[model samples]
Target: MKRRIVMSMFAGATLLASSLLGAAPARSADAPAEFGTDWHDPVTAAPPVAKPSGKSCQVTLAEAQFRDFTPYKGTYTPPEGCGERWSKVVLRMDGKVKGRQFDRLGHLHVGGVEIFRTSTPEPSPDGIEWSVEKDVTRYSDTFRRGQDVEMLIGNVVDDTYTGVIDVKVTLTFYAPSATAARPSATAASPVTNAARPATSTTRSTPTPDPTPDRVLTPDRVLTLQDGTVTTPRNSERIVAEVYATGSGGGCEEFWYLSAPDPAPYSCKAGDGPYREVQIEVDGRLAGIAAPFPHVWTGGWSNPFLWYVTPGPRAFDVKPIEYDLTPFAGLLNDGRPHRVEVSVVGVPEGQSGWSAPVNVLVWQDAKSAHVTGRLTGHKVGELANSSTYTPGSEHRVDTEGRHRLTVGGYVDTSHGRVTTTVSRSLTNTSAHRWTDGENLDALDAAWKDDQSVTVDGRGPARTTRTQRTYTMDGSITIGAGDRLRTVLTLGDRAAVGTTRAGRRIAWSWLDDTVEGDASWTLNVPRDQRHAVGTTSERFRLHGSKGCYDRSLTSVQGVLTEDRRAC
Candidate 1:
């Protein structure tokens, strides 16, 4: 049997009630905050103090200029009194483009060696303007007063109709303190030993390769294949891997360049394109996959030289891996089941989809017969839309003990904000599965949260954020198959005042096996009016693995004139 749980809590002071097992306990009015009070404070170190022994200097490495489909390079020379030994060195770039949007990659090189690289901010919704600041303290030795420094700016993409950009580069130098020890002249040189390994004709014996236990089969290469394609299935485990290059055209085109409309597009609207890969078994929907950029390739701006010397002359973008084990049972049938992979969201005439996908399956001569099905699928309608798909599977093996696995995926989205959450529960108990059974099980949960915010106008603003959180817990069976589990987790709470003087509080309770979790938001009342204040309460409960809930509320006193008291 399978079950689905749904819970919702509003923003203001209201009661949201739901039941999965039973009504959760009411939150206490005096409960402490979970997140933190001073979270809004900047978390950066104080500025470095200038040394009294040496003078500080600021130099303009390059002035503003406009370029099109070309690289920008300039030479810089430090001024005297900057000192050979420096404490702080910073590189700053102020840039703005009119009429179009673009993503620029900038590199700082000294004596032919690339030291640092960064990308300009994505075009703002209001306009194209940004300022980038990087700390080059480690490369201070390269800033010799008599030598020339090279700055390279590579335009990755420019969408401006006229293609005009105004950019300026500046370098700030802070000399070392009098009390600080200085390095010798030889140690101050930026160049390091660059020697290649000597060529030798010595033959080395090759080590034996490990025995192969897995098989990889190419299903479909979206970039090479014109339309939908199929591959023969023959493996014990199947994995769908997708490698996406550039932006999957169509609606994705706006991702690299600023959209002319700036309004949200939808897949059905013929303007909003989404990359969705669907998998089918015997012409039935089996699983769904989404394409994400590989960190080494498209995800990162400059992979050439960052941390190590000659890091990677070229980018070798890897593919994202998704487990299709939930549908493994349907494919494990003795007969060769038909499998189909399809790519949607790409418009005609525009091939924005450049995903090279492969479906790999492992084969085992003596595998068990398996059967599985998804049930209780539900989607919640709220400011934050959430979809839940849960499934249960059982494997019949020759051994007396059978394997059972329960898994699900929960995807939540609010406008440009989206979070993907997935969980799996597995156990190998006697074939007596029942409700409330204390079956020794293993549970794993993971969540990926992403949000994109656009400010009307800004020179330096955070426009995008991506974060991930994961937790794993397990229940062990004793010598006689007795259930024994020890779980320890922490809860987070936070209370702070917003810039608008509104008292805002947020709390989260992370429960592993489902218990009563609640939070309270207190609103200040006007003492002059002698009015009693009320606090908002939120509660969540379920039997699923780890249940994570966040409640945020703003509390303030309202006067008769409609102003904050």
Candidate 2:
């Protein structure tokens, strides 16, 4: 990781003038004949400042095009709660290699701050000591975060490609540095200070540590107690202790076993006035092993204890130097497995063993046959009961006939496990699980099969309700044959277009239909031309969950626009 440089920006006007003056070369007094004349000439000497140097650079992660590579990049749209935001970004640089002289370079720091400068005068024959414009830094400051819209690199040199260069950008979340001697983005003062001489100046401002409590120190071990050991296959024991630290209020300590080989473990010490400690194993509560009443000094000592369990699987615990009988419960069939490890009082949650530990245990391809009732199943749901004779034939008990009857409710949420079936599938009508289908067991099924793979870990579905509608009889208009209209859909029902080809005017029977909900329309009116009558028509288009055809069951004379469209 590259260290970041937090440049504390100073007042600009004075520094700009000073930089311009410093760029001029100095003339020797002996060589100049008119040295005593007007000093306000164009040949005035520039201020002597430290020479700036740099090398090639690269970025770690390719920034999102919306974040870095475009005009609107890095511009944050302030949310409702935000008013004024301040930040100090640290520019980190690393992986520098020597480059040829007089080459223009463009480099960006890890903090996304860019510095592009070029040599004004050509370099000497030795490829060094090239003079450059002091105006670079002054001009660079004008490039605000939101203003930069383009980037171009110029003047490449060969030797500069030696190694890699890394820059780190550390952005202060909401506020600028308070201890900085310059103008901060906080509440500005009425008076501003003048700029100092532009040179290599070190401004040491304190920064807040991101992980203050993460630092841990090992103190004296007051007492080490190996707690009551459990049987070698199951069960576990826990231990607890108390330690005194100068800083109080619930600190965590990581523990590791010292016997055989050192393995790391962790437990918590409580917030103190008086620090109390506790530990648990396999979810079983243990005894307090530290902060005993027998105290000899004013300070406290940390308690130490361990839980001994039988090892895993058929592997045997070798006879060691110490008491092997105490940890017999940990000696089981030797196959590494997941074990829960936790520490109390620390906000950091459980940190289990990084690596699984294998223990010897009895070996067998154990198989269990169990049967349960399939109640509360929906009609047409299937269930199977078959005896598994591994690697042999499967005997279907009662011919594996188990189907949900008319009134029984079936839940696809809790998966239907057909143990005898060769393929795993939610929709049995779909392909087999081995054929690109995601397979899930009982209690691990999704409420809806359409859930995305990532969210399929849980089961839940959307609730659906049915709507009902009924159409009223037709009404008469002018002349022609009377329109024989039948109610296609009831009130409040989403009506689909029953017919197509001819445009018809339709709307909801009432004025309240909206969205893709429901509608009523005009079919065909009568054929009266005494005053030149016009008929209304409704149009229909294909939409989600809707048919493409149109329907105008009854007709009405065009008076004006209907309330529903």
Candidate 3:
């Protein structure tokens, strides 16, 4: 597949940026019976990063090859021509690999802000390429000045494993329109560093308001240094995002399938198949959210199932966002405060999880110091259970849930602002496997709900969000020594915002993937006759925009695609 460039992000940029996606081509009359040296490149059905219509600037962030754990480190200078303020900022990463290799986890960080997290695809004998695009406008605060950069895609190379990951990352900045320009919005200026060389960050024109809230992303993004954070004294609002992943090819990589001690299972954990990400400030519970159950390309004990179409969000990992506004009152003391993150269900003394955090704050413009009190902080009892049933077909049924609510008031420049946040989470699964684990399957679902209300002298503004994730599949070794897999995965969400009990904006999203693959087991690469089919349907619509489409592939070829909606 040919790579797309983000040279000019104007009209038709979205379609042009649809790398390895869109409609399929004419099919051949005959199909190959055996696995070949090459196949179609990997692709996903997620919507492309929407670009605005305007002049744009592009900067190469990093380029490197990974053969070990050492990370690629460098420096990033702001785009020379792009204005300080922009309507949007888009991130694109293109990668290619060939020969033999295992799937590898990757990360990209700029000035300590983890902007992107992903996993690589196992390469074919010949070669394959893939691309990913994500909207990063909210990080405009971090891009307004020079910063340090780092990236890593840990891999290994030997006589047998030969594939070396090659990738290039870039950022595109789109200029704001005349009406969207914020000429007078410079009351809160961008961070200034005298040691760094000046670039386009110094602007004469007004910058756009990237978000409704006065976002104040610190120039030096925090990484929870010793589980501590020091926010501005005048900060009136706070939010934190966690890019958490379970990996290392150990039991944690397939964390959802792990079982508690003595379940006759190979992998054991203190808790089974249920996990939660929690946030705390000053040793008090502040916020919580559910982490997405992510599956890599080599997941489900079958690589053929994902050689063409991957599961949702597999290519572009998204961070779990937490509204910590209720803790602003306590964090606005100018002194360092203890901040912590913990995954709820992992066993003690075990290692295999990584959670990097980025804290975002909004400061009061008129006051040098803002102070108040945390009125309420409540945490519901955690509900978790795992039942093991042993028989011809051993089974484990598990259920876990938790809830938290926090309220506080911060005296800002405008007035006293009271904020309340409530969040809840639930996870349930049925894991079954035959004796010797010849046949294994899992059916699981998870839900994360959040609501935030901001009350001041005017009508209160509220935002509500409900997110769901599901996985149902099975891997079996049937007659004739044939190994097969049938699986389905889903990622969906519904969001709404209101004022004074009236809806102002809303949106819904649903992305589903299904596949069936089979091949001769315990055979040579050429001798194993492999066959597989995968399809994805993604639909999204609401106040911002609309995207509805479906794609299908057979024998590593995209067979059907249409924007039917």
TM-score, per-candidate, Cα-based: 0.28, 0.15, 0.88
lDDT of 1 by residue, 381-472 (tens): 11111111122321111111111222321111111111121221111111111232222121212222211111112221111111111112
**What is the Cα root-mean-square deviation between model 3 and the actual structure?**
8.6
What lDDT does candidate 1 reach at residue 341? 59
Cα lDDT for residue 89, candidate 3: 82
Candidate 2 minimal-lDDT segment of 10 residues: 302-311
lDDT score of residue 189 within candidate 1: 10
Per residue, candidate 3 scores C-alpha lDDT tens digits across 372-409 of: 88898889999989888888888889999999988988
Residue ranges of candidate 2 with Cα displaced over 4 Å? 1-84, 87-95, 99-101, 105-153, 157-565
- Report every candidate's CA lDDT: 0.29, 0.17, 0.72
lDDT of residue 213 for candidate 3: 29
What's the lDDT for candidate 2?
A: 0.17
* Candidate 1 deviant stretches above 4 angstroms: 1-54, 64-66, 124-126, 156-160, 182-565
By lDDT, the best candidate is 3
The lDDT-based order of candidates, best leading, equals 3, 1, 2
lDDT winner, 1 or 3: 3
RMSD of each: 25.6, 35.7, 8.6
